[model samples]
Target: MPDSAGILPLPLFSSSLKRDTSRPVMLIGFQHQGNLGLGYLASTLREHGYSVLTCDFEAETSEIIESARQSKPMIVGFSLIFQFYIRKFDALMQALRAAGVDCHFTIGGHFPSLSHEETLRMLPELDSVVRFEGEMTLLELADVIGTGRDWHDLQGIAYRGTTGVVTNPMRSLVDDLDSLPYPERNFEPEKALGRKALPLLASRGCARTCSFCSIQTFYRTAPGKIVRTRKPAKVIEEMQAMHEERGISIFLFQDDDFPLFGPVWRRWAYDFVDCMHRSGLAQRVIWKINCRADAVEPEIFTAMRDAGLYLVYMGLESGNEEGLKTLHKQVSVEQNIRAVEMLKQVGLLFEFGFMMFDPGSTLESIKQNLRFLRTILNDGCAAAVFCRMLPYDGTPIKDELERAGRLLGDVCAPSYDFLDPRVSKMYNSLSQIVDVWGWIHGYRALSPQLNWAWNEVAIMERLYPGIDGLEEYRRRLAAVTKKSNDVLFSVMDNLLEVAEFDAAERWDNARLDALRREFLEELLRERDAFVEHNQSTMLRVLRAQPVQEAASA
Candidate 1:
């Protein structure tokens, strides 16, 4: 057994219920984007000889009811990763129950894993809660249920007992990730940004414990190794299978911190490149990954690019040094800049997670963050819009706020007010404008054009290499992207300036509505010009003819 030093212990019991393995199991998730956790769980259950069916959160109420009625599962497991979805999950459960498709309901995922008892109390319809690292624990539970045995002795589970709620000790982490089967992706055809895509995980667990993130708490409380990776050859073999079966060329590495975790990652990176080359999949596919700013080594990234890494996502979090420290980001602003520069040097496109507001943010710090965003925007990086830090349950930040008596609202969806009310007011005001202009207008309307342009460029680079005008086409697309981002930042700056001055007066509902309308009209006009220019450029690229051999005549 690994160290259980600071972890809490739970009551254990012996099961009295009989197991029924022949009954089907159904997994439900709000994962239109793709739920790797659910996928892994389904695969593991299937390996243990259980019939499984899945219902995405996107399914209509009628469809979900029909699926449950048809499957008549013995277990209906709900994956509740985010706390914000509790209300939705509750409504869905009520609907399913009303539909008269009764079964033993269990909930798991990040939120439920941490607050299992609270979740059970909130939704009594759920019969049990699967705790951390559920693969083996769930498998064992299935076996016990199959044999009509007692589940009280099972580790890593919290279930309603005849007396009260009974909890069990945590399970050990899976040291060898290769021991698990690849996630079941055949349930539905997956797409990302309107293109064929597959979600892949190279590793698990993050090294850094950010105050605003719950991943640290999730893994820290579990036993055994915190981070585990599959063999590079195994990873490639899975990707190769996906390529052959689904023709999926675009892959999204869903690892929390893709390139961190010490020398193990360094070795994995090298071996991954080698395996890709040996397997000959490197030239046929392009992929994206997420990592920290401090992990952006030029040499490593260059090798990654050579192995088909075209895009990267970094959690810069905050540009302000103080804000960075508050979030326990550890890395300095200089490191963030250096990371961005390294990606630029390696010719990789990147998007960033930037937090403009935090619990202790002041007006000056917000300005610093704005300046930081402008610097990155000017450098041709796409910012993932500006937002305040959310203090999630089980995160250190949430605990700190709760201890300090600053936490407010529901535990499932807690809200924190800023220390400086003016900063809060500014955020609220600017967020209103940003919601309409930046999010609805800019990102929804204009960002897709840029992504489509990049997709075209990638296709041309791979399919028609050495073709004339490729470089020119790339330059044109980059120019358009930069221009659109510039406009986005300008709008943010303008809103911030307005908020800094006449915040109370300009924040009136009627005035804000007028301002939103005006900004929307202006943004649409500017977005149209950029989209037209990009579409024309793409048409030219598509129309360009390849060099023809001399005629035989």
Candidate 2:
């Protein structure tokens, strides 16, 4: 643990009150596809007569310092969602302080909320941490700071005092979500991937308590309802406003589980479609959502598609029954398969979140996952990638691993090696390949190509729907993408098998490196071919369209 003695003194809350209430309350967050958490907080703060400024993760340290200096916020709230970004946040805060930008600093979101004590100990620059749901908590804290009132008694906050760290009692969750203000719309039209996309949250919290998920733990610790949703009318109102005001034609629902609220979901779905139809935004704006496997139903998905649902991202987690049980997924492999079939039946594009390795993973479990991926791939379901299950802080898996002495690394980045040597070796090999070929190449190199294609498809669908061969072009591009992804996964599986055998025979590093490079080259070639084919086809489709349709599209 680092010493906090040399940390800078806390900014005077009294001085902050002298500033105009209209001065923005700056909130910082990571560069995710969309950060609705900060958006919600910003909107809530605005409702309470506090102005807000949101700085994304991509903002350089110098840019942040300049922004803060200009905004002159009384308090700056940092959204510490991922542990991996804590170090970056720490550096940014240090830079801000060194630059003489004095302000009260607070941190919130999953990481800080879950491990507030550790966070305070690690980051001395932060004044306090807002736990669980932050809307009301942050509003109250700002009021306290503005009025120079004692903040120690505030619930849902952990702060340092003369007596040391003081953690207040937990705050109750907001019961009527409809009462809350809609999240602020801060979308940059030019920066959006050719289509102005807005992230909307229909619900908060998940019904299932997966052992490896921090969200489940965060909600469990907070009082009140586990899963709360806004009224369908309110949801539609927000969407309509964005579409009509900002020309946002795409909506991405950032819900943990889109349709897992049981009977409430069916009614909500129907009402949502009804509202969309009434508002006429359904036909104008296409959307994507995240949900669980068991929540899938053919009828519901078909209705959603008709209401302009464009994509569905499902958390399949694992295919092996034992792996599912270990993770407490509460859904069977059959359920996952059924969900895929439902999406396919509805002709909806989809993606999956799969875990190929976990704490107790063995070669047999990995093999099962491979078979599962193969099944989905051959069925032409969607692009699926497998990752190792990370035992996030405050999760059941983290607690269990710590108790068993299997957990490694500090609280910020908890990791563990597999008990099975074969699994460990295979993972090491596959990870190397993924680092070079799958992760970096796929996200950095191939993502733009895919996003461009997606944007073109959305444009054609919206502006020139009656144009010839547009649907066929979409289908062909999707097929190429699916095939390309399948080949990548197949190569990964082969590399894992080869690594497992090589480990058993104690193969030399030179031999292993050579094999890895060979596989990587093959993957790169396959990826390039697919990207080129998609790009060429997209260009052809646009060029072949009638001049008026192309101009409009």
Candidate 3:
């Protein structure tokens, strides 16, 4: 439509390897280690007459980059879902550049789609960023880029030029999902991928706004504004195929919002769970789904658990009213509490996410949050994650924070290297907040930080003056904290280093316990120093508050 015939990027396939119409163009769909976006992109690529190469970003960035060069693919795409994966994306892009290879380096996923400008700014090596619904955009891109024409004119793509940033309008949402091909796993059907669990999306987009969120913003990409999902039977078919084909036993429902309609969700949950259970598929397969905290009912929980539901990922983003109010999360704390209790009593395991930092938070508000966790989920059945608020540019909250001048001018930072020279120690304070939130929440919300950890929180809050009583909560969060930390760390560690997981498994029993104790000791030492440092810092911030307010006024 827009003179794209001439502007498309060219694909660089191996010269020795003759191109055949039957030989599908290679589509590289990569996500981080043991990730499920792996499923989404891989499946779609295979459907559109393309062979797919899949890999994890956990391999050294150089490794991922080098592999692309060696494979000499037609298209190399990275799944930039997490903010931390930016460095790896750049590394791969760089490798493509170094080889002078014509491989089309593309990125399109939840995180990148929302922040296309950021992607352009950060990873120039990427030829372009697909703004939304990558399966189609990628398909069309491969056709155009491989043909050496005007993919730059294609809709829903973001590329740059001497003139400036060129952002093609988002393509209309796909109306008919039934005809879409199933998600393709990367490896051969004969190979066993072992028992690592992953999340899969049956639908695209969320319809609700839980304050401290970007879900609603993500939903806006679809033109008509409706959550689209595959038929329930097809969902079952995909799972069945994966189980039979790839030996995949566990699946996570990665929908922005599963069962957007309450009644529909109930009906689907009942039918699907019962169906899976009846067919004996549930025996071999377990699932984890993401849904509105309030959408789940006692019956749904019961049916889900009976159907071998391993976990239901919940977004409890906050414990109190104030935090929920800020994000406009459209649900109540009571609803959250009720939903959580039902899941627990129904024998369902849940991983609920909570956020501590907010734009207008006060000391009392923050404490109320900690107290909520302390009071509510202090057991093994449910968990809480405490993440910080990132000023995602497309999120409603981001708009609010930006207007209030609390939004960080630059939300983009260096990609986290969990195994890097400097940063493997911990994510920056913001990212630490994210991981710690998950860590603490993972142990069932009642988990406390070690003495030293709490002490550190206290000291930081004091120094920062707005973070509230983290040190105090850390101290109180003891047994549950230790166990929760272990659970959260262990799951993540297993997921992060699956190849070395076997070696790590040997120490799981005693070694995990020992690590917990060792972590506790480290927290204790850190806590003492934290107290002294924050105490002085708190006094300074307090004394300056009056002057700060006056200057702003």
Tens-place lDDT digits, model 3, residues 308-329: 6756677777777877888677
Output the better candidate (2/3) by TM-score: 2
The clash tally of candidate 3 reads: 28
- Among these predictions, the greatest TM-score belongs to 1
Regarding TM-score, does 1 or 3 come out ahead? Answer: 1
Candidate 3, residue 266: how far the Cα is off, in Å:
2.4
Rank candidates, TM-score, best first. Answer: 1, 2, 3
Each prediction's TM-score versus the true structure: 0.85, 0.84, 0.69
Error of 3 at 257 (Å): 2.3
lDDT of 2 by residue, 1-553 (tens): 1123211112333433432254468999874676778888999877666779899867788898999988888789999878877888888889989988677899998889889988998898998999998998888787777656667788899988788888899989888888888887674633332346768888888878999999988888889988888888899998877765666667888888885447878788888888988888776678888988888888888888888887888889898999999899999998998888788778776777888889878778878888887777674334456678998988999999999989998866779978988777777766554443422235543323443455455555653344456555656656655654565566556756675665232334454445445544444554445445555544665466444433433
Model 2 CA lDDT for position 87: 81
lDDT of each: 0.73, 0.74, 0.58
